[model samples]
Target: MANPTNFPDLQVPGGRMHDDQELCEHLLRSLDRPALLEILPSKIDLGGTGLFAKEVIPEGTEVFRSIPLLNCIGHEMSEFMCDYCHTSLTNGIDAAGHLRIAGDALPTISRCTQCGVCSYCSKDCQRKAWRKYHKLECPVLGQHPHASAEARALYRLIAMVKQDSLSEQEWRALAYLKAHEEQWSGHLEDLMYYQPQVDNPHRSTPLAFAVAARSAVRGAETLMQPGIDNLQLYGLYFRILTNDMDVAGPLHPNIGRTVDLVGSLMNHSCDPNTFAFFEGRQLRVRSLKPIQAGEEITVSYVDAREGFMMRHDVLWFKYFIDCKCNRCEEEELRISTLMSQESSSFEDFYQAEKELIDIRNEVSRDYKAFRSEDGINQVKTAISTVVSQIFRTQPWPDTLLPMCHMKQILAELSFKLNTNPNQIAIYTLQSCFGITQRSGPHWVYALHSLATHLTPMTAALNRLKNTPPLLLLLALIMRLLAPPAPPATPPDCPATPRQFWDFYNGLLYELVLQSRKTYGTDSACAVALVEKYARARARSSWLGPEERPLPGERGFAERFGEAQVAMLG
Candidate 1:
């Protein structure tokens, strides 16, 4: 049968699809409610689909939210994180596997009494999980407490499919997502070598598929779901490989994965206007910039802040699409032209870029390497290496996106280490400059980090007083960072008669407002920032009454630019 969505038939191995044709048809049907955004052929690619705004979407506006069709905590994190809300329960845990919050600081989390695994943040989450698939999964999970995360997640999907647990609208929404099965079609053989138990590993298979197959087979036996076949199981696996999103929030202690049928409708762009954040089980998509009517709503499939080559590599290998976003196209052209013009410049960039990539690859291969004390020193070394190579060219080209990406990583590492606050501010500011000179998601989050880092302004100000360059750069950026109009009433700080503290309070207030727009009000980051502003403002009030400004701070402005440049070095 012809595919209803009219994308190519799923590239199932041996061209065999056991009883999946109905699903192919089902995916094309409409959802129960009218979609918030229009689904249409993408202007970026022919025969591809994308989501578009139906009306003007102001920056910080929430475009849509959806509960995951399925969710699972990562295997590494399943022990400490709530299986339902994905909250961390580490602090509350005791030896007996019973955990409760004192003073109701947070909802209490408890391990499943029967399974002694899969903690839930509240009884409500437990009941929701039970009704969804936990009732079928709990007994199986009890017997095999060590099932891989993918197995646990896929088992739920298979059981739900067999029992018709999914709402029809959900099944329809999922059908709309097309899988890149061809990417996995070539990995079947390698799968069986690693995992012999899978009845029929495809002729081409990778170890990842083998691991997934091993989990699926074990789960099948444990669940005893009738009619669950190899092709059916593999079909679900490929969909997850293609469409699953990381369940992440600024407050999340560890990342997990989930499949949100409607959330999967948006396509990838290296310059996406919308970003997704998770609140408990709900996924919310919000605009990062003002999106006018008819504008296509896009989200980055990979980290958009990465250099072009890295972004391209991920897009091609994982999603099987070549990004043609304007930023990607321009960066690609600029790099090629720069190489043709100056071979030495290109060679220098290439060598430095390769080193950074190697460091990243090493960290990915062994995450522990980036977390150890030794890893901290290695990152310090990497930062020095990039900084040295960066100034080699006169006025480093902004197109060297990798340099910015390197700075971003260095900043994150610095923040994680929490050893040197000065370095964190410098690296983060440098990274933000490399991408865009404007306020954006990067700026919002970076400022949030700084504000959060420097809270209780008295001590922080005293600590950073010696670093005038840092303060000066922050003031300049935050001034430039202000939106055309304030999102809310400015906290009682006046523009004239401004003390540096006035600007500082303004910065904190603007950051709190912008963060709420960018990350939704319910976001943990936004909430904390708001409270921090209130306390900071109150403290400023107690300091003293404001006086009219005295002028005549000569030559400070001229020295500002020069000092900043020297400080950057």
Candidate 2:
């Protein structure tokens, strides 16, 4: 069957898929919705499919957005996050609507009466999900309480596919997905050689194929249903490992994973021009830097902070690609200072793991008693000490799991009603890794945190040339994180005068012009700094003209006045 949209299958000049001059026009036309940019499914010089830009796409502009073909929240997080939309249920609420207690059950939570297995924030979410796929999967969810995240995802997809239920493009997309089941058999054979029970046909493979045999069979039933056997479950699991992306939103925690056929068209690169994030269920991709009309659009799939050797190993293992991106070629990464020295003895690794778990549990208990801002430092100190205790054997990078928890706590502590922004910024900076400079989901989050803590009137603006990294960070904060709508700006917050606001605005515009040379005109970093709020009526300025990065640059005196501004217009 051909694509319903008649999106030409990837090919090159002379009807071949190599020696590509330009092949994105056809795929760009195949997009189902209006897009500021188009996708070109063409072959790379490296002998694989690649997505290219069909036009000049500017940075900060929305590239495209795609809804998930199939997605679900992990079973462990089902109670704490919405199963349908993936909204976090972490905000504390009471009958009076003030956050009087910590981690109390949300008022919106509505427990399902029939299955008693899932929770929802509203009946609308419950009804919509039931109509979509939950009716079939609900019957079996109870039987697989300990199922792997991959197993749950497969179950949802298998259950959703019905006769005449999906569109032609949807079916074609599903059919074309890569399933590394052949790779699975090789691993199984090696495991079976040492442990024969692993190959038992009657036994369901734990984690890999955690669903009950009868349950999966019933879910995938239909005369018109595409054939999927028990072993094929492994194929689904493998495809998910390579293709799925976590769904995240502005205010909610990441609650689910999604995949799309066109989304997979883009090839991997460490230094990519494009970056992606979630707007609810839709995956939105945007340019991180400007691209010429014929340029190829790329996005990073792995954590870009790790060493090149570590990155090479992970990419080869999961995505089956060896990155030859510029950063890889330069080999200029800041190696980890995060050392956790330890012996490799089995007993030592085991004991350290136990101590780490105990510490985490203790921290969780103490975290409950103290509300936001109360004893935040105490929690941070205790957590950091525990992280140290667990580090006698494992390298710090290997202990990323615990370190992740520490960073999260520090972030939470930073939001205390009257926490010191400078103090918070210092602590947060110490926890950063090498790749935290430009982008990463967590790094961006930190940037937003730092932005909120900054009082624009502070003396930092005068020293913009001192820390380019911090300047880039502040710009990101202003662009991505808006002033909390409706100004719950704390009572203890400093009165931000007009001249101070003008200084920040003018400084941002100055950064924008500088970024055109360093990053790109379309770079999101520069665009954020000078986009709007920085321009106001001119007034007398401090800091001489010599302080300007550019000779002809405008000053706070030239653009903005001593008038308080609510936001950039």
Candidate 3:
């Protein structure tokens, strides 16, 4: 559906307007509609504040999906190019005939074996090269002395072009280069001039080169489509390839498109709602929280914990903009010594909160002893104590502790369970479940806490089903504790999962009526028990078939039997 102009306006919780309509319109147009809507706030208040819904949405809802406005595949798809051969080091191949993987040693240019325009280590490399576009351009290279460089330059050119739909001028440029191989050399020169150059005596063609470069640059500028960013960084790398011919790179197939869309929209925030996951080719956006309709959707440009100065520096380099988010505003407020002193009093008190510290230390020690002995009982005791403390503390649970302290406790427990998935892990998990159940049937943390414990417990259960009874007990506990299906409504909004649970239970009650039509009331009771146990805890007060209906009570089977038969028929 097309984006509606009348969608609710979103503002900060306390009636803050981050941007006006003109800015919002510009931002929305810049983003793909689906991506924009994924982060948009649900409703806007007249005061221009955005408040998120308070319900928890299911985990795998399709938030936003989109095809890139521009798509590009790297040249490696066309040829077997070595590090020394490819212009983009980020997408370079190595001597082993493999795409150079990132975060590894840089491949040496000297190892490159020239097969034609492209270089490889051996025949296997040549074959790999041929599978790529190399075969298409290989023959033409032999026709021109500068074919290798020309092909490399053209590959880089085509790679960048893939990110956007080519305009008529770009289309004509591509066709012309394809028709006349020498034209690639002229285009390469134009790209080089677009980047800043340092003085070098060995550089070819002094005055004529300068004149040709200036003319080509001006000509290229005229041909370029409007609205495209200058992309000076990519241009700089292009210039480097022209100067230093030996640089090799990684096989970043998605670099072109990633830079085109996500890279273009990159913004910084110390706290961000949008997170990106790269799934091979496409970049996916997940909402960490419910975003309001008109709010500017933002992603963390760097790790969140970095101090303001460091984070700001990184964002400036990437997005070329200064961040002025709430966190930064907090940092600015902290700079005043008077304000800092006042804030520090509460911060110190919170930091030194004795009850939190004692529980944390106890949990930590219990974890260590359990790990050393591989003792399930010890782990169980520790987990139980932690969960007890979590609930006793009211709203702020143990899971919401300060990062360092929370990580420490989680790490210790995680280590014991991860290293040894025995009875101890089950007990530790059951303790979490016990706390969740005790907390309340409808507690929000109940499902999340159970899921955290069960994820590992499930794997262990699969491996140790035939082991001890205690282990099996733990597994069953974990299974029973599995998080309820994600809440039907968004988390920050007013709706609660309990409402949805009631609706779902109503559906199950109806299903029981259908079962009675096929099997009779006695069988219907059994089905009800089974379904109820699967979805929720069994209650002692639940009626059985032998029991007569009370004054105002209706048996589920008797009340809905006719409807069930009609549905079946």
Candidates in order have lDDT scores of: 0.60, 0.49, 0.35
List ranges where model 3 is wrong by over 4 Å.
1-64, 67-257, 286-294, 304-310, 316-322, 327-569
lDDT of 1 by residue, 273-384 (tens): 8877666566777887788889887888776566777667667765677888888888878777765555446556555666777776566456545764577678768756
Q: Tens digit of lDDT per residue, candidate 2, span 1-569?
A: 23221222211124322223333443344454333444444444254456666677766555666666776665545677667764445522222323223355554655567555567777888988887777766766656554545556666665565312345455444444554456555654555354544334322233223223224444434321435444554555566656775554432335556666566666678777776655445566766778777787787766554445545655765566678777776652322222313423334433443455455445545654543565676666665565465455443452243344455456555645346654454444444332234443444444444434454324454444232223223332232233333334332333233334444445444444443333334433334433322322222134323233321355434434222222221
Ranking by TM-score: 1, 2, 3
Backbone clash count for every predicted candidate, in the order shown: 10, 7, 28
Ranking by lDDT: 1, 2, 3
The window of 10 residues in a row where model 1 has the poorest summed lDDT is: 1-10
Please report the candidate that would top TM-score against the real structure: 1
* Model 3 per-residue lDDT at 356: 46
Clashing residue pairs found in predicted model 2 = 12-16, 12-17, 340-396, 342-393, 505-534, 533-568, 537-560
In terms of lDDT, model 3 sits at 0.35
Q: RMSD (Cα, Å) of candidate 3?
A: 19.8
lDDT: the better of candidates 2 and 3 = 2
Give the least accurate 10-residue stretch of model 3, judged by summed lDDT. Answer: 244-253
lDDT of candidate 3 over 1-569, digit per residue (tens): 02211211111223122233333343335443343342123232122223122333222222333323222223332233332223223333232333343375763322223333344434554464455434433433344324223233443333334333233332321221111113324544554564444243212223233333343333323332212233332232233222211111111212222222222232335665554433222344445445554455455645443344545654443223467777677754543332244344433433333344555556644555545444534544544554343234332333232223333344446544565443434434433433311211112122323333334433343455333323233323323234342222222333122222222233334333332322223322224333442433122123222233321246633533322222222
Residue 303 displacement in candidate 1 (angstroms): 2.3
